[model samples]
Target: MSPSVSVTCTSLSFAWPDGVPVLTGLDVAFGPGRTGLVGVNGTGKSTLLRLIAGELAPGDGVVRVTGQVGYLPQNVTLDTALRVDQALGIAAQRAALHAIEAGDASEGHFETVGDDWDVEERALATLGELGLGHVGLDRTVGEVSGGESVLLRLAALLLRRPDVLLLDEPTNNLDLYARRRLYAAVTAWPGVLVVVSHDRELLELVDRIADLRSGGITWYGGGFSAYQEALAVEQDAAERMVRVAGADLRRQQRELADAQVKLARRKRYGQKMWENKREPKIVMGARKRAAQESSGKHRILHEEKLAEARERLDEAVEAVRDDDEIRVELPYTAVPPGRGVLTLRDLELAHGARLTGGLDLRGPERVALIGRNGAGKTTLLRTVAGQLAPVSGEATAHVPLRFLPQRLDVLDDELSVVENVARFAPGATGNRIRARLARFLFRGARADRKAGTLSGGERFRAALAALMLAEPAPQLLLLDEPTNNLDMASVRRLTTALESYEGALVVAGHDLPFLRSIGITRWLLMSEGELTETTWEAVADPA
Candidate 1:
């Protein structure tokens, strides 16, 4: 964080072309410090970052910044033909320097060189810092791994020396080693750094957390853990207020009832007196008028009290967040304890990565596939799912299997969520599928939404539902980076859904916290064309 850089949004607003509002009149300021911008999916975290980065225009209001800004979007796309120096934005400078060294210096070359005579050195240093030391300046972008391409983009940003840097889910496709390198960069950032991510480890490196929700930002000092603690305290107090307000509402209702009964009794007594002619006509008329006025006043007073009580109750309820959890039974996916799940015999994948020897998985074991970017975890999973033929050896599944790829392409974009689930479970009736989808948090109209219209979180839930609720009830499940790009709440919902799965599961991901939460039974390391058994402690501290 630097004191010279600042970012502020004044009366900011934006909406999609479909007229669905995302952010409206959002006013927030980011001072000199690393800020982790977080919220559930569809809360406009990425949209706000885009607004700040000038990638998207604000429909209303203004965005102000005091210095140059660089943004690393969630999806990093670089032309395969681009050279490393070109990707880092230093190719022109390097060429000018080389021309000068060759005694061919022109005024144009001098102008391009300017005062940054050590641009190449700085570029190499930044690349090395991001664990791209082996990547040569002249190498093509396609020569590097996907994770390396992400780091290359970040290096380009760092070379610009911008005062404000924005990153949206920077760790989405990165492996554990690459993520560590990214974490180092974030820790050492000197200017204003705003990152939108669900990576708990990355969030923990921030100076503060700005939670975007309900079209506004709630600032919390410290990292993600502190933010969670503060939020817990706030929610506890809100629940207490709700209880108190409910009690007051009930009390007001009872008092209103009692007042009405008393007024009725008085009216009855007056009527009886009038019938018996117990008082003079003039006095009786005066008494009747006074009784009517008192009754009206009393009735109005009680109604006002009841209204105030109801309003207070509504406010109290609003303070409590309604984050629903997925609660579905997946008994059909259950595998027998003694069942043979999968087997591999000296498996060699199409990509030239091979297992050292044979491997066997039994029962309802949950395996965590840990590897670097190009280690063939996905290829192995695909082979197990029978999507690919192994170049050598064999891979076999003893039970029904399903693979949820990283891209989540199992869904049909043209169909509604209910229709998609129905496609997977063709044997189930429409009513049965809808009832099961309700457990995935898609109830009523939500189930009717076209899959193409779903947000990232919603799409993940829909895809998961379609798979988990399939007719054959896959007894063996393989997931490749299932948590990538998912917000924390959606990740939790995924975990909840898996809790009831009762099947043999194999997940390939770098999210250690999530893997631990889902109770991974075994850890397998894929490195250098070999698979070896490992432990949680070993993976966490790979010294």
Candidate 2:
């Protein structure tokens, strides 16, 4: 391994217990810089990170690291009973320091606090850097929100100051504020930081992008934008190659046909000559033999040339990527221009978040719901969806509504994608449901796969298909962090799906780019127990 390389995996191969291969004979190295590991979901991105972090054992080959490694997994789950300091992995050190301060300077306490008398201060500072300064060391993990817990875990990792740090989908549950803090931390990272994330903003902070595809890594200089630009250029070249190869193949076919025609004509002429006794027997026989051998050679040469042209065309076509998009029509979901979609009158959600002056959504108005974690955005959406009752006021939907939660629990694990959609559209025939699912990119066997066996992106599509293809044809759609844990392709698929949704939308999420892409006409912010209409500028700046 090169000295510059912080982590190296040589001929790494891994497979699940079910005999599903993820990474096969993959060799890659992460040097001393921030690397954004990105790919479509289930492409072994997380698995690669785990292999480097030593959280998972590779089935074959080896992984080597130069220094201590710290990892924050995709789903961070700290014990609710543990204190903030304990979660930070500094409780024992802090205790020893306290003991030393209280005049019990025992040898064990000294050893525990050796060269780490400032552990507490560093921990607090790390917490502060991650916007967790408000959280005291004594506070239990249960007191913090999910987003805060993610940050807390990150803080613990930062406190370690490891030479190699691995983060998998670190921004999955973070709100805008937390994400910004993480971005800042990533900007200042000094070690080999490998982050596996679909967050474009987070990926933008990396020095390079390592795109994992088909068990191999393709290195791209710079961040997500640069990678995208490079991919576009490559795709354009690949398409051109395909076109050129296709033209060559066609030309080859034409030449082969011409050769066969000439051969047939020669055979006819020879046969006529032979029939007319135009030449002596020996001469005719010689001429016939020569013509037959020449014709066979010509046919073989033309066929070989045509086959080579076809092979070239196939190779060129293989270089081009197939990024299939969702194309669906939801005319039934369209709301009239002046139709009343939803109303919240003096609404106080079950979780104490309220709309101070009430809200009335009309027509096909698209609303973006923004808030800090624990601001009750989900609660408000649930109230409007009729899953929760407002504390003292009314929350009503004027049209058929569907709520797609963050968990995507709408799908049953045992049910096939087609079966799940059928459950939603009980009145629709099996063929009809299957046809609609095809629009969501779940054609044929893909639609028949059990929901439990689907990848993250596939599972998301299945759940979305169920909601969008419901029997009543929802006119009011409530999506909670619809982009969460979704790969870039899946996010694009979501955007495409929503482009065809001519209905009122209320989406609660921290993904500003996604919200902007969806054409949010109204931006609402939930903060300090109140909800208020805000401008896009205000939402973006938040000052």
Candidate 3:
């Protein structure tokens, strides 16, 4: 590794107790720059981050860090009793500075202060940058929303000023405004920053991309788009190689057949000549032996050549990913254009949000629910899905519905994926449920694994499968932050699954690209206790 590399992993290997290997013999070096770590779910992006952060020890090899490392994990849970200053790691310093300013200064206070005399000020400034200005240093973590807690955790890491920063899915719960703030922070990072995220905008801020797959990493210069372009080129080349290898194998097979036929003809003609006494017996026997030897050599040579060509083709095929997509058919989910899917008549949610004019979804309209943090987007979706009753007025779903919440709480932890789906679809037989689960990438015994053992992306998929495969065949599909914490491939699979859904869709999420990809026909922004109509462009540029 270069001396300039801030983080290096040599011959790293790790495996679960169940013998499922994640990273094996992996060696990589991260220098002073922003690198986006991207890959499909279960590819160990998060696991690698954890190993680099020393949170999880590698089963083999070593990790070397030239300087301090600060890691922001995907799931941030701050203690409710923790104060903002303590969370930012400035509470002691702030107290020391105050103590020295008020009266007789103790040497201990000076030592604690160190060089950070304005620690509190800096902490507040960091909070403000992450749109947490209202959160006072004395405020407890319980007072903030889930999104704010994530930002607060990030703020704590940023305040550390480490030489290497590792952020795993840092923008999972952040709103659009917070995401922009994070993007700005990433753009201005001055250390060796490696961020594992599926957020397209965040990935675009990276200086390079590291695609982790099959226990190896491929480095691509520039941002996510550049990585995609490079991958496409690689796939194209691999495909061409496969084609060439196949052609060679066919040619070898044909040559082998021709040689065998010619050897047979020679044997017959030589035998006839010997029988008619056309040539000496000794000469004919010698010629016959030579012909057999030559035929055997030719056959062996062609067979080996074909086998080698096939091996090359197999290697080429392995180089290109399967890219098998999630295929689902929901013909029963279709709703006629004139049919009413959902209607909220002057609805007032239990949380006290009031909708005066109400809201309605007709036919297969795809609605994108956009709003800032604490805007009641999730509450509205839950109300429409009948998870919560309206405080006043009427909220009705004209069709069978299902809600896949952001937290994916619908799944029972103890139940296996197949059993979970069975819970939602009691009418469907075990074989039928398993067959559908296979489409969601849970083939064979994978479907029998407990939901608690699943990774973040797998959990999301299982939850989605349960809702989509429900017995009633939901026609009003409600999704809240569907892309939250999902890897890029999982997001693609989600989009693919949604494409096959013929029902009315209402998705509340911060992922604009995902919403657009799902063909959101209408945009609704909730603010100040009301949901109002909006456009994609307007939402993108809310000037």
lDDT of each: 0.94, 0.91, 0.89
- TM-score result, candidate 1: 0.97
Report the lDDT tens digits of candidate 3 across residue range 317-394.
898777767899989999999799888888888887778886888999999988888889989888887788888888
Compute the lDDT for candidate 2: 0.91
**For candidate 3, which ten residues in a row score worst on lDDT?**
1-10
Which candidate has the highest lDDT of all? Answer: 1
Q: How accurate is candidate 1 locally (lDDT)?
A: 0.94
Alpha-carbon RMSD, candidate 3: 2.6
lDDT of 1 by residue, 143-218 (tens): 9999999999999999999999999999989999999999999999988999999999999999999999888899
Candidate 3 lDDT (Cα, whole model)?
Answer: 0.89
TM-score of 3: 0.93
For candidate 2, the TM-score is 0.97
Selected candidate, larger TM-score, 1 vs 3: 1
| Candidate 3 C-alpha error for residue 171, in Å | 0.7
Clash tally, candidates in order? 0, 0, 0
Q: Please identify which of the two predictions, 1 or 2, would achieve the higher lDDT against the true structure.
A: 1
How does each model score on TM-score?
0.97, 0.97, 0.93
